[model samples]
Target: MPMTSHRAALQAWLEAMPFRREAVAHLMAAQEAVYLVGGSVRDALLGRHGYDLDVVTEGSAMALGRRLADALRGAFFVMDREHDVARVVVRQGEAHYHVDLAGLRAKEIEGDLRARDFTINAMAVPLRPGLGELLDPTGGLDDLRRRVLRAAYEGAFRDDPVRIIRGVRMAGAFGLHWQPETEALALATVEALRGVSPERLRDELFNILALPSAASALEHPVGQRTLPLILLLDPLDLEGALEPVRLLEQALAGAVWVGAPYGEALEGYLRQTLSVGRERRQLLKLAALHLGCGAAAPQKAEETARHLRLSRREGIHLRLALQALDDPLWRAESEPEPLSIYRYYRQVGEAGVSGALLALWAWPKGSTGERMARRAHRIIAAWFTQKGTLVEPAPLLSGQEIVRKFGLTPGPQIGALLEALREAQAAGQVHDRAEAWHYLKRLIEKGLS
Candidate 1:
């Protein structure tokens, strides 16, 4: 798309948003000099929805924030005095809109542009009346057209090493190539990344991985440099060093669980792979231990689960994936019986079963793995429909119930009995409260004898 047309469309879109337009008008009328800046402009130029809009001005960010709050009836927050950034959050029932105002430290617009990480982001659109021109003093438009990432200034990395990850993220997000000089600077900035806080590093790594093209960037030479830096920060000697690119490829290509546990694991992987810190490494270990059901042996799965502090739901997902991995034929056969389907559901809960099926579908074709995954999805779907529900059976008795009914002391034996009962119920050996009670009674009697 032509830059002129792209800018026109973006202007139209921004003008259409009554609230944003009003906010811009409020800032402009004050004569403090404000311009729409940062990611919002970058994303708009790229023809994407920009969620957060940032504005830079010569006026006090806190003062502008208060004025905007009063005009829009929004809540204002003074973010940081050091940075001179303030946020105004405007809410209209379910919808939320954010407007940020920041102070400009530079003498000229070029100085502000030079302070940004990349050329594309350095470009800004002036909101002042008759000043609608895109101020691209740093050849941002040229770099954007070339789909090349370039540092705004030579000392950009020295000022903020987190830009290394941001560069990778933008490359993946925009499918842009880093300029040779930019690539060199990224490498030079690697050591500086160590000086950044772990939380900031963690956020950047995850944001990069979450991008659709992240898998490809992971394999890139620039992406590879991230690995050693991570290891240096948080050393972990596995049986062997994991190929970071290949691992990301597998993860991106595979069906990902988008739950709390999965999120935790992804964060952990980024941190551990990057060697973020000991606390982060431990979090990743926990997440990996609970990733897939049946992917590992039962004993190993249990051990890993205990070690990593996985929740019940996470443990269930890991176990189900492991189980699906074990029975290649379960997913290979064209038509699986009800019993097989029931067994699959029994092992993995509904979400886990769905996750397993997705993993199978993601398997590359012309391999036994692909065929197995295809067949597994077919069988699982058929059984799920036949049952009209794929809910995992609830435990017939609770731990407290076991204590009350078995006349057993409050100890480890109570847990053993409850687990045994649940297994029996899952195996279809026991049904209803009466059967559960009788079974527990027999186990308690046998133990006493």
Candidate 2:
């Protein structure tokens, strides 16, 4: 659709949202001049709605935010007291709307728009009766129409270097192109990005990783130029890393659980929350990307995490994911069989499979690599079918029972024996407790004790 049509359609559709009316009424009651600003305006004009809403007001932003929070029965937080920026989180069932209230940067809305980082996000709309008209002094609407991301000013990046990261992320997320001038400005100011707060950098990097076509975007010129600079300490070979990320995405794209009992469980496990809003899948893919280059993956991952200020769990997952690539087992020509898979599962639990699969995907797509890939896929599918047995099993014999029956003292031998029993159970050797006891007795009789 043309940009003009999108704008018209979104404008027509905007008034129908129930929250707008409630929000406008509450803000108007406070007698503050509030304008729906930033991404909310941009998204609404692009035919998307009900995401987070950013609002700028002439009066105290925190005061109005508290009022709106109370009116909407939401939780409120003061983001920046000096800037009078506050946030209210409104929950509706499973969905959440974050309404950000900030004092106007300038006396007028146009000046406020000019001070913004990107033109596409500089537009605004009044939060009052009739909702007034769309405010686009910086030609944000035109940029949005062109699918071009333009900076409001050349100094935008210098003012807030985080915008450089955000610019690439936005381009990737929205299929946006950097306007010529904006691209040049960004390139010139790229070095400043390294000095930004680790927390801010981490947030933006995670946003890119969370995207569906993250690798493609990172391979884009802007991302290609900036990403390595951001993680300059341990530069990424993005070309080498794309394959596994693409494969992981493909694996998770469909109704992966169809006809598989553990499909849902496996999907849920991969999607499990890690630290600081990072997911297991994100960290695993990150590990794959880092491991693609060469050795020193663990050190590289640690340095990257430290620079980005990633959470402890995120760092640990990355290190674990690299294990498969680093281990000699996967480097062999022959593919890992069921026993090897069970051994790997015991070695690292869930992360072991994820890492092994990433390694197989990253391999060259020839006869050997194809064989390994197929083997990995089959092993994963079979594991999913028997995930219950793989994850946990009822112990056939207890340590106390072994000690009492065999006259063996508590020591490393006991732990080793139990682990062996568990492995046997995993490999279908021991079914019943009697069978397990018999198996143990045979081992003892064979002088294995």
Candidate 3:
């Protein structure tokens, strides 16, 4: 889109947004020259709405944040007292937005713009009513028009190496290609990336993974060159890492149904909420990529997750993806029988869906292997579709029932018997109470139960 058309669209969109006006009014009451700078201005020009608004002013940023928070009945937080930066968080039901205030880092708005990381993020607009003119000192509008991501200056990466990770996210989110100079500068600062804090690295990583085209983001040449530097550890199996992502994309697209209830259910599985962020599905796929779909993947997942300092909940999600690699049905070259699928659901529960997705492409492509993989996929789908009935049926014999019937003590033996009975029910070997008792007698006769 041309700059003229984008400007018109931006104006229409900005005019339609009434939420921002309240906060702007609060800022105006302070009688300071304030401008809506950074991401808010960039997103507005690029036709993106609902992004956090960054406001820069000559007055104390902390005071401005407190004023806005008080007026809007929002929460005020001091982001960086030393740098005169603060934030006001406003919540409306389940939705939330941030309005960040910061003192000018340099003498003028142009200097502040030049000191930013990217050309596309170095634009600003007035927050004062009737004075909403764009202040683009770095030609951010032109770069947005061209769909090219360019560094604001050569030292942008050197200033904060984390920007390289943000670049990967922007590539996937906005479909912007990095300029050669920007890419070169970013690669040159690979060593400096090690100095970045783990929390920042972890946040950027999840943010990148959260994108719909996350696979493309990781597989893209830019990501290929940047990931190793950011990860900063052992050499990853890059091809192995990309395969599960490709499989996940296929599953999400309905090309592969490997055992999720429906395509939408599987999609919802991928979008499942996590303790930290709501990208559990994407993180699980990334985990599968890192730990190849092999028997030893779970151990590798543990080691890698520890090295990355993942949160406790994130570790659980990663383990679930790795656990898929350990499914025994995959060991059988033939299609999994109904009993095998039931047994899998019994063991892994809902997590099996994610595991199956990761393991789908890990299987061989030979004719026999393809058939087995498809069968495994169908079993997963059936487990989701029939979870209440076949997958988790009400066992005819409980632990207490086994203890009472056989005159045995309530011990591990009775628990084992209960498990056996449930397995029998799932395998279709026993149905009603009479058949369950008969099956138990056969197990005792064979000395198995």
Q: Specify the highest-TM-score model's number.
A: 2
Regions more than 4 Å wrong, model 1: 2-7, 231-362, 365-368, 371-392, 398-410, 441-449
Estimate, for each residue in 1-449, the C-alpha lDDT of model 3 and write its tens digit: 43565446556555766667667667766777798787877776666778377899988898888888888889999999999999999987787878989999999888998999999989887666644678888888889888899999989999999898898888788899989999888878867877887778777877887776677877767677666655553455455576667666665665454443576676676776765574666577567566543555666666556656786666766776678657788778767776788787667776676677666664556775576567656866775677755788786767777877877788777778777887787778888999989988888778765
Model 2 — TM-score against the truth?
0.91
TM-score for each candidate, following the candidate numbering:
0.71, 0.91, 0.88
For candidate 3, the 10 contiguous residues with the lowest summed lDDT are: 230-239
Which residue runs does candidate 3 get wrong by more than 4 Å?
5-7, 28-30, 254-261, 291-296, 362-373
The regions of model 2 sitting more than 4 angstroms off are 1-17, 234-239, 254-262, 326-335
lDDT for 274 in candidate 2 is: 78
| Model 3 lDDT, full chain set | 0.75
Q: 98-178, model 1: which lDDT tens digit per residue?
A: 988888969766688779998888988877773377888788878888999999889888888888888887887888898
Which has the better TM-score: candidate 1, or candidate 3?
3
Q: What's the lDDT for residue 103 in model 3?
A: 97
Arranged by lDDT, best first: 2, 3, 1
